[model samples]
Target: MEGLYIEPTETSPKVHFDPEAFSFEISGESRPEDVRKFYKPVLDWFEQYSNYLYWLTEKYAEGEKKLVQFHFVFEYFNSSSAKYIMDVIAKLGDIQKASPNAKIQILWHYDEPDEDMKEAGEEFETITNIPFKYIINPD
Candidate 1:
């Protein structure tokens, strides 16, 4: 399937969802005017890709890794954006639950000395079963 690549704007984050490579990433800031509208396509695309993944595994091969590496690098986001983020995470969790090979590694990137950002990542780790890798920016 073709991938999704949305450029970042003043209010939205950069998005890259590549099912061919089995990866997804969202970076930059996310405080769009309509959070649901902005993220709806993302959810839609993921649902389609997830169905493909399940079909591929069930028909041809079983136990193949459905590892979708997801990166979330947010410099800043509003409280409203948090709800959308959780939606993405929950969808990922559903993908994981549907397939044993569906393991998602979420890498949360924050600037150095940004304890709040780190804490946010930790909070996500507690909220979902998706494994998280917290990364501190070098710059």
Candidate 2:
């Protein structure tokens, strides 16, 4: 299955979802003028990816769990983007729940001293019930 990749812009984030490498990342700012338009494709991609993962798990890795890493490295984002971010995380949680052979690791990256960012990650963890490994980026 093909993955999705979107370059970051002044008002949007970078999205890189590579199934072959089993790597995913969403970084940079996210406050696009059309939030829905910007995130709709992302949400759709996740839905399809979830299905693909399910199939792959059942067919190939029957007894083994495949580790998938999702990285989030945002410098800033607005309220509008937060809702979609939550949706993305929820979808991931759903994927994990549906696929017993799939394991997801959410890596939330933030610069040291960004309390608000850290708090946001905490809030996401609390709401989604998905444990996130917090990584402090160096200057």
Candidate 3:
């Protein structure tokens, strides 16, 4: 499956969903005027990717386990964007639950001295059951 890539906008983040790498990343500020519109495609892509992966494994009879890595690193976001972010995390949790053999990791990256970003990551961790890693990157 081809990867879904969206470049960062003035009011949005850079999105990189690479199936080959089994990695997805959303980073930067998000304050899009139309939150739903901006995130709908991303949500759809996740659903499609999950289904494709399931089919490929079942059809090919691959014994290897499939894992997806989601990286969320936002310097700031509005409340609406936050809701969408949470929704994405929930979707990933659902995928993991449905596919016991499939593991999903949520990596939350934040600026080392940014207290707000750190706290935000903690908040997400509390809400989602997915395994999360908090990474501090110095600007």
* Each model's backbone clash number: 0, 0, 0
Residue 81 of candidate 1: its Cα lDDT? 92
Give the per-residue lDDT of model 2 (tens digit) for 1-139.
9989999999999999999899899999999999999999999998899889998887654568898999999999999999999999999999999887888999999999998999999999999999999999979
Off by over 4 Å in 2: 60-63
Candidate 2, position 131, lDDT: 95
Candidate 3 lDDT over 1-139, as tens digits, reads 9899999999999999998877789999899999999999999998987776666555433466765678888988999898899889888887776665566788888888888887877787789866688888766
Give the Cα lDDT of each candidate. Answer: 0.83, 0.94, 0.83
Q: Estimate, for each residue in 64-84, the C-alpha lDDT of model 1 and write its tens digit.
A: 675567889998988999888
Candidates in order, TM-scores: namely: 0.89, 0.95, 0.88
Q: Clash pairs of candidate 2?
A: none
Comparison by TM-score, 1 against 3, better one: 1
**Residue runs of model 3 more than 4 Å from their true location after superposition:** 57-64
